[model samples]
Target: MPYVITRLCTNDGACVEVCPVACIHTRPGAPQFYIDPDVCIDCEQCEIVCPVDAIFKDVDVPAEHAEAIDINASFFRQNKAVVGPVAFETAWQMVQRAHAYAASVGIAVTAAVVDEAGVPIAVGRMDGAAPRTAELAVSKAYTAAAFHLATADLAAQARQPWLRSLVVAHRGRLLPAAGGLVIFDGITIIGAVGVAGGSATDHDVLCCQAAFSVLETGGH
Candidate 1:
């Protein structure tokens, strides 16, 4: 069985840095980190390094932390896939790099980094960007993260009846605009980035692409 991170997890990131496969993840405000059953390699590194002793093999979880197995498992069940919630430092770097890229190209934009579940990890609005750009950026990131497809591809299908209905069902939180791209860590999806308020959708996409270089070069 895969290892599980219980409520005792402190999100201190000791285990995250130790895991060979990078399957441990938690957001900034999350109560604890979780291990992805789909991606974990069964290495006990997390359990070994976890300062709080929160990591446990599924079958070995103590009775006090037994519910943690379901909590950890159910988080992935709610998403199409949940390899990561993305480390906060990495998300921050992505947003900063995205905004820097947009500025370099003389464009004003809002950039957002969201986890696999489409929850915000980091966000930034360049100077002079429109206020509403923040919402669009987040929606675009959510579209890519929630569906595992870039907004460019999804926008083309937004005209179809089914796509239109899907957008509506989400109460318009899904943006089929061309500025979102999913991010990966060694073939495992970590999160997504979205950019908005650039000169054109293509400009937004270019900025989004540039931000990915941060991860490529640093593996952060």
Candidate 2:
């Protein structure tokens, strides 16, 4: 889960400097900083550097500021990709569209889609994809959905001691590799797309990017 910036934020911007992904944002006149959940890798660097001790993990948010969890998430929901709620059918359509794009480019790949809860909604492997491609795709999709960040971004975070400990704590649930992207409806992450069986990480990222583009255009 992502961390929450509480009211105690002193506007020091210390957390912002330590964040490798630069997920923290603030304006000159703003009272406090905002951490974009979609971009945070949950590396806890901000938590370690906050002079005011204002940052808290989503699940550990104080009772008085319990609303901050939703508050942080709602900030992203302002511009939704779909007018209505995302559903299983919509997730499936996204995977199908990604598969089609991969095929068109002559890249046989496996793709997986997972909902906001990191539950698998749809998965597919194009003909001639590696046998293990489906499993890798699913793991990548789950990681993106659970962390609310692209797997490529996570690849860097995975090198951190805290992040590596998290991987051990989760027992390998988090796969920090390329080819996974968070699917945003506007700024709110609705799901994630993951692709595998490409010639390299860059190729896998390309296929996932195509899928994200479809989501960005509202599946057009």
How many clashes (backbone atoms < 3 Å, residues ≥3 apart in a chain or on different chains) does model 2 have?
Answer: 1
- The model with the greatest TM-score is 2
Candidates' RMSD to native: 13.2, 4.0
| Candidate 2 lDDT score relative to the true structure | 0.78
- Candidate 2 lDDT at 200 equals 67
- Model 2: per-residue lDDT, tens digit, 1-220? 7898988888988998888656677667867887777667677899999988999999899898787777666655553454333566666677777778778778889988887767788888888999899989988988888777788987976778977887787678778899888776656667788888887688788888777665567662
Q: Give the CA lDDT, 0 to 100, for residue 27 in model 2.
A: 60
Question: Per-prediction TM-score, please?
Answer: 0.62, 0.74
Clash numbers, per candidate:
0, 1
TM-score of candidate 2 on Cα atoms, chains taken together: 0.74
Tell me how far candidate 2 lies from the true structure as C-alpha RMSD in angstroms.
4.0
